[model samples]
Target chain A: MPIEQDYSKTENGTQPVESDNQDSNKTPTLPSFTANKSSQTVNTLWRTLITPNSPNVTPNSSYYELISFYVYHGLLVLLYFNIFIFGLITFSINRTKLWFFELAYNPSKSPSVISADISKLNKIPKRISVILNLKPEETENGGISGLISDSSEVCAWVVASGIKYLSIYEYGGELKNNIPELRRSVYKKLAVYYGTDNVPTFSIKVPHANAIYYGASDQDIDQQRYKNTSYKPILQIVLLSNVDGRATIVDLTKVMADLTTTNEISPKDITVKFIDDELKQLVGEEPDLLILFQPYLNLQSYPPWHIRLCEIYWEPDNDAVTYPVYLRALQKFSTCKVNVGK
Target chain B: MPDWMSTFPGYQQILENCTSLFASVVRTGPVPQHIGFIMDGNRRYARINQIEVKEGHNAGFESLARLLQVCYKCGVKSATIFAFSIENYKRNSFEVDWLMELAKMRFGQMIEKGDLCEKYGIKIRTLGDKSLLPRDVVECLEEAERTTANNSKAVLNVCFSYTSRHEITTTIVNILENVKKGLIEPGDITEDMITNNLYTGDQPPLDLLIRSSGVRRISDFLLWQCHQEHCDIEIIDTLWPEFGTMQMCLLLLKWSFNRTYGRKKYRGKKETKKEKEKST
Candidate 1:
């Protein structure tokens, strides 16, 4: 482990910031904030610096994935330098695309104005899933607070746009640990958009952690009329990370394998529907649209089963959680036609 | 009588040679050992071009052959094409039947030609439940596999009548069958066990997955293999029929570029500061 840390330190410059951010997120308090809009502007830089973005090559899911993950990545460092010009040209092309999108979608547009733009769209996704990445703390609106605010910002937009369910996936699962702060942040953001008196109720679900949090406090007399019809919240939010994706499936397979040995379940019992229902219970239903707020189209190990038939939207060379990308994704979703296997 | 490029006798050979030179240059960088293709948008291409659906499929098959040759030239070890899906069975009966006929015809052609197989030393494998296929189609696929079985170089995974869920499910069933026979224990079922048990398990773990016509969805193809960080899913705007060898080569080149300088930018993020402190 010590050697691994030393190796990481020498290998990646972002190791220091990554470890520092981890310590801050483990605590459950909100620090004072001062916004710096200039640096926080969503840019293509700094995305590649994130570490442990790959699955842990631990002994858990041991040999095959572990061996290949390293083997394939290890080959990248061979550095033939033959395709250097080709690489440079392709690299510049990607950044140019990001610049084009920046011009198209102005980041300075306020949330309500973007909401109106979203409202003008002919259709919207009922269930929307987003993949969020955490930036280093040195930048404004980066790290833990940035993740919470980003989640809250999306929640507020979805609520305004009348979307029912939203799943926010951060690779590290840091938001899962800070549910209360996330709830507080989300509620505050909702109040900003919907006004405090008319704030709609919502719930935050962390399926992996087996916890559900409500936006409205129980002691609040303003929420007393909603007791009998508690079946549905206006907004249903689920937080997910890499753990809930493949690792969950690996654990389920182990369970099924164990059950087969005990004669509790037969080999034939592991059917498509059986695994589907089981995974649906473990991770929520497949979203109608999966939006990745990354520079490129990488799943970053999203729950694989749920991605089937789900339309994915991501801007090229863009990696910030902003209203323009979200609004554009909704527009894209509205234009898409999902004819299952037709 | 001839395609426009082929109208010029020397044009075809020169183009291929130049492409091979370009491919060799790109191949000098990191190359993904295994590549997967969803091959979407054939029907759309047919609709747009006002061609018969079968013709669009034929065009797609030609494109795939050319692309596969290019991939071999670029030094990829194996390639998986989602030729047919279990859910694709839901399409109209006529189309399904024609698709099956297409598979049979294509597999038979590959075997009969014997040139591509001999040239590339390609081993052909059909992944999915063979029980679902018609007996005649099964026999053709089997014959193709058998003839190419001894080829020790590369593999072409034809995912016919396959879905990732079905593959994982059946793999579990096979594992349990072993367990029932006392050859394996339930406790031994790690992820690698599940991985190795799948039909394409012996092939390299998918490095790059490509889908055409700009639909950014996995569509239940290689869901297990592609979820990890090692795999990159590229959704191109070109329809399958219109997808060309040059464009496909560009995609492969993009993958190599990203793996080399693009993504590796993160690997040395703080190395300068760390090295300075160590030197002091």
Candidate 2:
């Protein structure tokens, strides 16, 4: 007597394998047919004529099923094509909108355009420092006036955009003597942009959103001197070279050596904190964003200790300082996630 | 004979001419005091080429030998290569063993040919944890270092089983020990002191850092020296085995341009006045 076969396994294996093989073979055929037929009517005819055999399918029902399958698949293809086209159209529209916005509001493109969106300015960094490369002959060939105009425009934008604090540093020692004239130029430009009534006054003592100029001799190396007053939201103009003329590190080293010789203090106790205390006396506070108006990332000896964590922004090929480029740099800085060596 | 000249007999004269030309061209710009290399993608290069892993490592070594010669010609005082990292020890045992064997063989070859180091005056110093390495490998490294101890024309730093964090931690521990011993007081520590105590204390701070295989991360190499300094980093898409002197020269040219034109305006007034007088 013949033993009963395991029909369940046979059915499960053979049915799926056969169906899968058929599906694998038929899928490519459909696409090839559609590609060769070219016209919609021929595709319908081809689908109807090439109805593959199914065990349970009758001629009449299979014909209707095949028609429905073609109809549904054609609808899906149309839907996907429409979606892709719509996506492209929307992307182009959004890009054009952004381009138009940039063209109209970019101060670099048209220096006279002072109008900028306050919402966009809300994202500006709270503390922004600009390091300008100032040459000795900056006064010649309209460079000084051009700088004054750029400074005024930048200051006006800062005020209008509601930025809290702005610091302008002349990287070389040449511009140190002309801080007063530069400050006056900036004040005049702000007045012209915001009208005399709204323009913030230039003050040396009061804690308000005002322009304060610091020449090399004026920068007192006493941290206690700035402790009492509130460092209010203000524009600070610093006419100092990138080089630390005071040689703070060298002096600190000397101080440490002297302390080690006399008091017998351990040298390892002179940590970054002790150095930071001296640095605080040198540069008041570390800037959140440092913008370099140069072609490359040569810090020009910006106080090394202070800029350890500062985010630096500089364009490689483009050296022309424009208000729009400055704004873009600020925008880029706002999006940066600073990893402070943690 | 130089290492490359022995390796490639037909191209000896061409290589010498190219070396001389590069030497002349490099003198026009400021040479980087120290250059660091993050060698990456040897295994990937092997995988792509369908070659034995050992062959890939040998190719990388060949490229490194050529690069060292170019760096010496360019007047680069010190060159550091991340030969094997602490993290690299986690790779498969087969690959790790192959790398270890390859390193031993290369160091042994260098030791055998004493004239190569003598000709170039290259002081080879391995920077890493010595205890983690095998006995023979460490012996080879020690031998190479001992033989090249006096050569000072150029320095080669092979970071084997090294990590920047480990280096920093080790330096700190040494400093603490000195403080405990009263050999150095805690209050005397400065940036320069810390630099002098580091593994690269005798060498200048890294001026240019080049990473191969298109990876942008520093991969924990030279953290202390590169962090606060103006060290320029160049990431190239080529694999370590494919990197050559031409790629290094291109990077050097860019860095030299940045140094010359980028910071020239910020020079002190005295220097500018002297230039003006010379022009007049």
Candidate 3:
């Protein structure tokens, strides 16, 4: 089978359908509506046939189960409502944490403060990836501009923490479309910290589009005090969205299958190491830590091939992209030991 | 505590009746057709209880048996458990040997006792590279499957020496081999094709993936299947040995509840904004 067929049958199988057919045959009163092609009549007829006006109640296991389920579901609904209330209360508090975190480490605060906070961690991931959600444009920190500013702020935090590689994944691929605006926003934000004279260089890459944009113009680099060598940026940022996650893998799989048919590659050659290396080349290498800014943890279809051993971090009831979350994720990655299945 | 509770008259029978009733009630609303579990923290549970590691794993097995009984009772179509990972072999040789021995002994017990598979009509399928397993373990696994070969009610996928990466790779390899054989064209290699050919091929789509020990990472168990929008990956803080059937039933109910009401914490997970709006 080339597809996952529905092998699942409920405890009640085709017996329900067979019984319904028998009911239609026996009931001469239902034939007029059954003969009618209108779905509206069929629905009412089906409903009447299924729900008898008088149910012969029996105080058996099935009867007791109904009462227990009522109580269970009633309690669950109440518990859910309670959780929603708590979520609302914590949502306001977490929103305040965003402001407090920014106030403690904003553009006005020198870059040294951020580095000091980062320096406390035992180890920080050289490569860190984050999943950012794009909220409705009506809400604050929610539209395209809000997304751009959030991206820049995270970029600033990543650079200040001295992390070299950063990947930002927006579920809808919104940031990929506004790269120029993102580059300008990040450059401005970083310049505020390091000052216009010596802003660190960074590059933004969209792996799906195979596009790269570097920060700092050639003339701006020419004015630097020390002649920068190696010609590499201090930070490398990769922009990924939903399409870049699994769609790319499917395309690669098709190509590989085609190549095999043409005798270009052997079937045995497509081993685990082969897939890993291919993914490393197609999609980027797996990041050591992934931070989700959502209130709860859901991958939202991040590239499955790359998340083999990477640690994922997310805050409960925290939705905004904040500096505190990023710093805390790094701190967690530092203290955590990735045994890599030892 | 467990021994004392079991010492009471009709304790086990009462517990079973309660679990079956709970499962039946949950089955009334919605039941996940396919479920996956990452049984973690066995070694940690062993150390915490000051027991031998072997006994911890044994307890974990007991918990699995109990949970799967509830799952099948709830009419869950297929239950996949991460019995062992390919990476598990990287552990010391002694542990690996013991784990194989434990599997062999437990599988022997399962078939002999006419346990869950026999009672619930569950087809036992060992999904992984059989070549890597010791000969005795492989034979025992085959025996279990052979005994349960004709079961049509449900399926139990025991991922003994498995990893998601390995499963995907093996699936791809098998696909390519078929293409080379001219059985199908390369164009047939769709995402569904790969998904259906994995160790979990032919089973229903995975609905719920539960990992114990609060380890957020999936540890490479069904990585491909769980990335889908519908799969709910629930991480519980309980150790594998201590995990209970009632906790699992409640988790299933929570998943159904969230799916029905579209809980915000669980939103943007299964449905995108536009799709949710369209559905409303």
Count clashes in each candidate, considering only residues at least 3 apart in sequence or on different chains.
3, 10, 0
- For each candidate in the order shown, give its overall lDDT on alpha carbons: 0.78, 0.63, 0.79
Ranking 1 against 2 by TM-score, winner? 1
What is the alpha-carbon lDDT for the whole of candidate 3?
0.79
For candidate 2, write residues B192-212 as lDDT tens digits: 776777789999888988878
Best by lDDT: 3
Per-residue lDDT over B14-89 for candidate 1, one digit per residue giving the tens place of the 0 to 100 score: 8788776665455446678999999999989999999999999999999898888889877889999999888888
Q: Compared with the real two-chain complex, what DockQ does model 3 have? A: 0.41
Query: Residue B107 lDDT in model 3?
Result: 81
Residue A19, candidate 3: alpha-carbon lDDT: 64
Report the lDDT of model 1 for residue B133.
86
Reference contacts reproduced by model 2 = 0.03
- For model 1, the stretches where C-alpha displacement exceeds 4 angstroms are A1-115, A216-229, B1-6, B264-280
lDDT of 2 by residue, A37-136 (tens): 3575665666556653432222433344445434534443443455457646865775565455557656542224443444554355676667665434
lDDT of 3 by residue, A207-271 (tens): 88887777744355533532445577888999988787668777787898789878899997787
Interface RMSD of each: 7.7, 19.9, 5.5
TM-score of chain A considered alone, across all candidate predictions: 0.68, 0.54, 0.76
Return the clash pairs for model 1, or none.
A12-B270, A13-B269, A13-B270
DockQ of each: 0.27, 0.02, 0.41
* Per-prediction share of native contacts kept: 0.53, 0.03, 0.46
